[model samples]
Target: MAKIAYILLCHKDPEAIIQQAEQLTAAGDFMSIHFDASAKSESFAMIRDALEDNPNVTFAHKRIKCGWGEWSLVQATLYAIEAAIADFPRATHFYMLSGDCMAVKTAEYAHQFLDDNETDFIESFDFFESDWIKIGMKEERLIYRHFFNERTHKSLFYWAIELQKRLGFKRRIPGDVQVQIGSQWWCLRRRTIESILDFIRSRKDVIRFFRTTWIPDETFFQTLVRHLVPENEIDTRTLTFLMFTDYGMPVTFHNDHYDLLLSQDFLFARKISPDAKTLKARLGKLYSSRGIDFQISNEGRSLYKFLATQGRAGRRFGMRFWETESSLGRERELMIVVCKKWHVAKRLTDQIRQETEIPAIDFIFDEDNTALPDLGGIQSSLAKRARHRRSLMRMLFEYFESDRLIVCMDPSNLDLMHDFFSDRSMTRLLRIECDFTDDYLIGHARRIGLAGDRTSQLTLERLLPTIRNDINHEADRIRDAGFSRHFRIRQSDSTETNATKLVEFLSLPYETALKLAQTRQLFDD
Candidate 1:
């Protein structure tokens, strides 16, 4: 039989750990637990008694009092692994889990997923460099300094500094890569576990270094692995399961630690609290009725549902392929000039008339003039903005009808156009910050120019070259207008506007506004 070992580092939650053990044992997996020595003796006794009937449960004898921000937890974990190795030599994998954490996927499917990925699926949480942790540390330091003496302050500061050094310290491992140390709840193959243990045993200096460090359990293993394996082989984003909170802190469910697990498509389901007696009955019934087997994980089901809905919506929207046939023997290239204001549209039309002799430029404004009321109020202002947005969208759709390349001068206009014609292939001259590269806009135009000969789906990759070309052309025209050094294309996207308007809108400081205007002009030029 294939065996998997679970290393449980219990703190204050003995009951929760016992309940988790029950579930693990019932799932037909071998289990081993290491209780923190700092825990009350009565609690440990209760835990031992609860597991006495279970043949798979083996309790460790060593006791180590683990303080917050100390190496005690790592020591306890190492001891547990050493015991497990000696007892279960045939075990295939080792999974490090907390008593508070619940399994979001069924045991069998979770195992299979791990096997397929050739990695242990541990939750990354991504809180290492988050603002929350930064703020928390600052606040904690302040409190300690105000209340404690020099010796006490030194001890606290050392813990904090050491933690920062270990966890947040950047190290260039093999492959010329760099990454910070991570958490303790990781998965490892049996061989990897043995290798890690052997390496630790050989490195007496490393163990000595960890003795004074804060939360060495989180960093020690990660640091060792990064040094040993190729950086790419270490799966950092293995955290598929998430316990949603208002912030980073975990929320309790049913008076126990039950974190909600979110699926890949953002669908969420509650993980049953370990201590909840009604879990088995409630989950069993729900699982059976929903036809969710251990093999069909929550994420798998969510992905299937997401894809089905997207396909249905795509069909409903009349998603069509791009016309690839070039305009053979056609005199004009399809040109779409999208703009917000009628004056700007007219100006672009005039520019196109002067620059491109081969293709006639067509301009369309989809503004709903009727929606604007003569009366002055918030409603009227909103109506005017809506009309302006709509007008830009209409201009975007018009690009598909023409054989010419498209041009959008205003960033806002481009955004509205992209949103409206998301399903269609249209070229625009604006680049949003979210775009990966400057050529996104240029490529769109190039693809449309080539579309006369080929038929295919228009993607971001196809449109970038056209975007760059249009930007360059626009820059040349601006330079010719004699405002070359004073004005430049900071961004062609509709999100930015004239320096005077942007400065006022952003409420930037005077000096900052001037600097921004300077950069904005550089792009405009």
Candidate 2:
């Protein structure tokens, strides 16, 4: 058997780690976990007990201080890898992942896929031009000055500005520099692991540089891998998961539906008024209405009764009865759209509402809103149409005070709309577009029956969206955003000396060329 070790560095939410570990172990994969030593003793004990039953799980002790950036994370990761490699020397590859990461496919499937590709799936993008790295530097400088120099946690922004003046530096890193960046989660060949460790041992300057950097975790491995391996040996573009977030939190269905569920008395065993008889009677009727013929416990019956009331109230108010919640927190707002045929929209809307936590308002163009209208005085020319559309978008955006907005569209229609909203400024108008095309890949996964539990539905509805102007575009948007450099048509791939032609054909902006070259992984992916 080819051994693959799963390495996780966890600080909080050990349950999530255990959940992920269970999936890996069931797939016949080896596992090693390193938890922050500074966590509460009870939390550690709970994690220890949970993993004790799993023979594959090995826990390591590591002291990690919060706010240490990637330095602490890398330390923990390296320690786990060393231990895993020591015990499983014959292991074919080591997969590094976070506790929060959930596998969309089984480990066996992933292993086979990797075996077929025969490539290391580490994101090897040049990090120097990445917005995250530049932002990290600015954030670190500000935090250091406020907490260390001023001896107070407040005024970090002011102190950062002062320090910048004294040091004669700016927050932005020049795009030409070859810095590396990627997800900490990666699958590495044994040789690659050893090479990285050996290079780190010899590069004292690199270690010193990271000690003071804000997000050392994201950069250290990227820089080390870039230095140790031939670029071609590394598959910089491929990612097993495409993570999207608003307001620095993971978006999930749980967070979005809780509020709407509660408002209608459909959650918490229908215990809203504490009248057991009323709850049971209501729940019994609700079950019958849904064609479900299962007996509920007294508690379960009450809960269902309350949920039915909540569902009725949500419908009366024209609100989404289900939603996926974002992990960002309660302060954010969210909107979700799913592209299906006209009849499918209603079912899709219900499914989306049940699965996500954000408040979703279904807008079926055929049922709720009119199709695109020809704007008066607007010419059909691209420039004229784009300007007019922008004007209309600006007016609509100003009406909402949300920090995030998502526009979900059908895949077939994406190309038609790309020309109207290809500008970077659209990012400021709409932050994310959840294209249903991407969801097709997961259709083969096990299907859970439709849930009508008011409590379940209520939890789904209360979730909100944070981080205004978050955009989720399909592959077309990515292509329009100049990702063409990362890939070439099969025919063009064999052609030599076509760099000029490629650039001209793609119509890439000259200003972004250097940045594109440095961070090619974004396009390559």
In model 2, state the lDDT of residue 205: 60
**Tens digits of per-residue lDDT for model 2 on 1-525?**
456777777776676566657656765577778887767877878888998888777765455543444356677888888777776666778877665444433344455556766656666665534564322244443223222211111135446656867897644432333457776667778888888788768766656556545555666677677777777778774343332221122222122222322233111111121122333333323311322222322232234335445634433222212121102223332232323322233333333334332222333122324222222223224444334444433222322323333333343344324433443332311212223332221221112222223434343333212111122334345446542223322212222322333233223343332232232222121
Native RMSD of candidate 1 (Å): 21.7
Candidate 2's displacement at residue 193, Å, is 1.2
Please give each candidate's TM-score. 0.44, 0.45
Deviating ranges (above 4 Å) for candidate 1: 120-179, 238-240, 244-247, 253-525
Model-by-model lDDT, in order?
Answer: 0.46, 0.45
lDDT of 1: 0.46
lDDT of 1 at 103: 57
